[model samples]
Target chain A: MATVAAPGTQAYARPALLDWLTTVDHKKLGILYLYFTMFFFAVGGILALLVRTQLAVADSSFVSNNAYNQIFTMHASAMLFLFIIPVWAGFGNYLVPLQIGAADMAFPRINALSFWLLPPAGILMFAGFLVEGGSANAGWTAYSPLAQQSGSGMDLWIISVIILGVSSTIGAANFMVTMFRMRAPGMTMFRMPIFCWTMLVTAVLQLLATPVLAAALTMLFIDRNFGGAFFDPNTGGNAILWQNIFWFYSHPAVYIMILPGMGIISEIIPVFSRKPLFGYKAFVFATMAIGGLGFSVWAHHMFTTGAVLLPFFSFMTFLIGVPTGVKIFNWLGTMWRGSITFTTPMLFGIGFVSMFLIGGINGMFSAVVPIDFAIHDTYFVVAHIHYVLFGGSVMAVFGGFYYWFPKIWGRKLNETLGKWHFGLMLIGFNLAFFPMHLLGLDGMPRRIATYSESGWEALNFASTVGSFLIGVSMIPFLIAVVAAFMRPKDQPDDPWEANTLEWGTTSPPPVYNFDELPEVRSERPLFDRRHPDLAGGGH
Target chain B: MAAIESSPRHEEGMSNGMLGFILFLASEVMFFGGLFAAYFIARADAQEWPPVNLLTEEQIAAGVQLEMHVGLPAIATAILITSSIVIQWAEFQIKKGNQAGLIWGLFITLAMGVIFLAMQMYDYAQLDFGAGDTIYGTTFYTLTGFHGAHVFGGAVFILIVLLRALGGQFSAQRHEAVRACSIYWHFVDVVWIALFTILYIVPE
Candidate 1:
């Protein structure tokens, strides 16, 4: 083994510290991925607080106009690239092999390579701040012309993003091959767990969409360094061309960020409701439909640029809402008239459903051409993305943490602390972001350092206070994690009476995952194993 | 100890490694796909075939033509195609358990790949225009340049596979590396052909 890391292995006679650094074990890598992404998660949150504090008052002098650009741009770059996108890779890494009854990922060494690529890329990206011009100030979108005008920091950001894209692309191939080939004998496609299914589709999206981003970044790099005019209008190149290629990848990137979150909530909803996923096949097809439609809606983000065919992109954008809506309804259907519990994971599952509904509706608001013209770059657009990403993706990430914490760590987070974390986050999240809708409608532009003494001060203040509250919500979560670590590894395999195969093993499975295998007669192999009489008959 | 009780390797299909390489190739196709889209967009926005209007008089007078000179590139493309065929033949030799054929085939393919890259370099030096001269030069160089990079990567990959083949590491039952290398080399060849057609054969 090239890596010396070992989490659940006793056979290897290496020190515990060295085991972690060089370990290629999927579970260890997964935990490393989580730790790395969450650190950036906190970093991004701090950046967000800085942004909100500056925007809290009109003519706020908290940050200079130039400093504000770096803060906000790095904020988004950290959250999307460092945190949300890779977090699913983290979850999928830990869970997919266990769920599929495979010993490890299809390519274990490549899995390590995928993970190790991240730290350097992240450092290279954030290292931009230490450079002369500060970090990439052109926003995460990094539209050219502006992208060209930034200093070496922009080049660093470009290279780092391309490296990150390479990580996910190969990581996507690993996931696809693992799920496709490694399932236990009886586990067919439909019988795979919902989380695994969602991952499969998300991997497909990452595989196809991420490379386009790499290509665009390369072009931008050329334009900056090699005097290429891929997007320079002075050289007969269309400025909109940058947006066209960027959104071609990024629009699908939206789904890449959220689909696994949807998958997590789907799992939590069904398990807590004590039922099968409502319309499981329909749900699967809906996820697939979302992946397919995700490709067509890239132009929607470009609608306001006026170079796009607004109707086609608008129609495609609204059409994507259909599959997403179907998934939402399926979650509801799983909960309808079934036994339901509001454990921390369930609370988040429910939060994901409700918040994503709002996200969907607000997203629709921007899909309409005239409405987009009004809200195009406004706080409303800001509100829409936060609702979808923070409300949608971040909510499910915590739910996943709570849901899988016992299984991964072999100990439980304090439930009350978990509840407090969830409640504060929900309130703080809504407080911080919900007001942006009103502020956006009132004509406050996003990415601006300050506003005049207009009537927007109050809402901005509320949003700022809310952003802090969201930050404060992390206190309980930190406590819960620290407290959980103080406990013994006493969790049984099926702590929550869960139905999937992951719960069939020890709380933390052994080095090679399963000691013995269970028969994969249904999607819920463990559930069926527990109740042979109800096998294949129970919902 | 197998450690695992149920046989995960019992599945009947393409090996996971092969499938993964194919998917990786899929991403490669999309990467090229994005570059191609940029090319067409650049072309669409331009006034003429080579977009010489955007070039300065000094650049034109200095003998920079956005229209590619195809003679040497044509020879390089043929060499690249021949390399692809030789690598596939190497795979067939391994499948027939003929190590000698496999070794000789890989050697020939490696030689062809080097020659092709050398010829491509010569062609680039012989060109009247550099990558920075205009959008035409930009798209031309970016597309072919990326393709050239892929060919370089493919050559390194083949060298590794060839080393393994020489090390007595492959047989009829186990030459996945050779197959993967062939698939990648073929992809690089196909991409070059597409580059040659669009940048050289197609008119404004």
Candidate 2:
């Protein structure tokens, strides 16, 4: 084993462009995903601000209705496809191998292919905005008949989504193979990190779910371009077919977005509390349950469509909360009565729990079939989604970045700036979205370009102001990252004294993760190796 | 305890390549499953079979439309199914260190694959209607087009394996490439059988 070259010795050779293109090194691929997702995030955020600006005034036009439609469409398309999904993949790519003590992902070239496919997909989606009619105006759901309406942009949207679906399928296959085949010896399934377990389930969902989306899009494309009548209500085809296909994929897709964030919380809580995760087995079961239950609840999105059967889907939708509730209790249990440190990651984790609980409760309200009919296409639904996605997923994503920054960059981020960022973001997020619930109940419908004589002006103004504050909050976060890069390195190998295998290695781990892979006796092998007494004790 | 170093035997762990192939096939199953579900849903609501009938007036008048075009597709399916067997034979030969047998078996498989593709294209061209003419034509073409693409991909795999065989890359022990190629060929064959049964054998 010692005869193998030292970690950096293999890094001596300058690699070619083709080598970089084909290289399966998880770290390089992870960085690529990170940088690419950041670009998309910025693009998607700008689109959001543009949409908010349009909504700021009542019947005071900054942009045409068509332009407003394009803005919001691009915003949803960019955020969901390019920003959220790839951001999680970026974190998973970099950290999964490190946590599991594998040298690289199982199928490295396939990994590279997956990352490379995203840029073209993003280009295709944005290209829709450049066309004559502008991007798809029909909401991200892209319901049929609206989606089937011939426009220069609709075909481009279809093509881009299909390409992105292919990329996701390939990536999902790689993750599954890696987790199953490439773990270090003694790293049994139960002993793997919570993040790894979450990723495994997420990949399974992606594998099963994404292809259905691709099929739906393909059918739409055919209906539009080839004169096929798959979704044409005038023909024998049913319009509700599109909704069924879209939500079947989209609901599991919600899990795809949140499950990894849940994993990030699971990791952060156990570390900060200085205890083994309370009810580790229960948490694992909850993750699996979330993935399993995700499929049956998709019809909840169609409650207002009135096309689907109600009681069965509503039951499934409400049942999902049980497993999700179990997760929240497990997290609080982990954080109870321990030597807790309030790191930036922990702050974000706690924020995720609090905000996501509100999001979940609001979701439960929507699950009531009659209530969903009331608020179905209103701003309440909009606010609830943002709370779940932004408050839950985006916050957890930030937590992961802060927690894993030292391992990836070998430099500690400035905690002062992070705290400031977190505080402002939390305030801005609630202020922006919380009032949306009231505005929605007050009878201001969603997807409308303007409102007239409704007394919605005050709430809309408040929401707009909050949106800008959320934008401002990003400044401190970006500045902290810049500061971390600019400062002279001052990070130790294990800055957090973490429990995972990743922290056992050097800061910014060697090209190949470990010189000799350690045999795992428990989930927290590094902690056990370093502190035997703590391993045996509850705390 | 002695610290053993640099053991070549460590490389003998269960093959990653084979495991990767199985996982890839699993994903493919989900992909095809989605398409099949679409077909099932579409068929369920289908009020009259073949919504826009494509049979020529003479054939419809004479009732020849009900007659099966079994001979051509059966030949094609036979060629594809037989190619799978021959590809496996090639893999077995390569594993046994029989270079001549491996080359001949691979050559035969490739020839049979090309014949199957040609027959498939002929069958597609001979369709009485275009894809946009009717719903039956649309579903038929889309499903079969996707199947053809898979066959084309399988052909490329076989061609690459044949080229590698020519270059003397495989031996008795290290033959994962051959095994993976054989598995892919078999998968394509299985897909063709399903397509044949659904599109041809099942009465409209």
Per-residue lDDT tens digits for candidate 1, residues A138-161, read 999998789889979999999999
Candidate 1: CAPRI quality band: medium
DockQ values of all predictions: 0.78, 0.35
For candidate 1, what is the lDDT?
0.90
TM-score of 1: 0.96
Residue by residue across A1-539, what tens digits does model 2's lDDT show? 13245757756565667666666789989988998998998898888888788888788588898888778888998999998988888999998988888999988888999999999989988888788898887888898787766377988988998898888888887888889878898788888899998999999899889988988888888888887767764444668888998899999999999999999989998899988898888888999999999999888899778778899999998899998999999889988997899999999999999999999999999999988888888999999999999999999989998999998998888899999989999998998899899988876888887777568888888888888898998999899989889987567768898888888777777778887665588899878878777564322
TM-score against native, each model: 0.96, 0.93
RMSD of 2: 3.9
* Per-chain TM-score, chain A, candidate 1: 0.98
Stretches of model 2 off by over 4 angstroms after superposition? A1-11, A15-23, A516-519, A536-539, B1-14, B53-71
True contacts kept of each: 0.82, 0.34
Where is the poorest 10-residue window by lDDT in model 2 chain A? A1-10
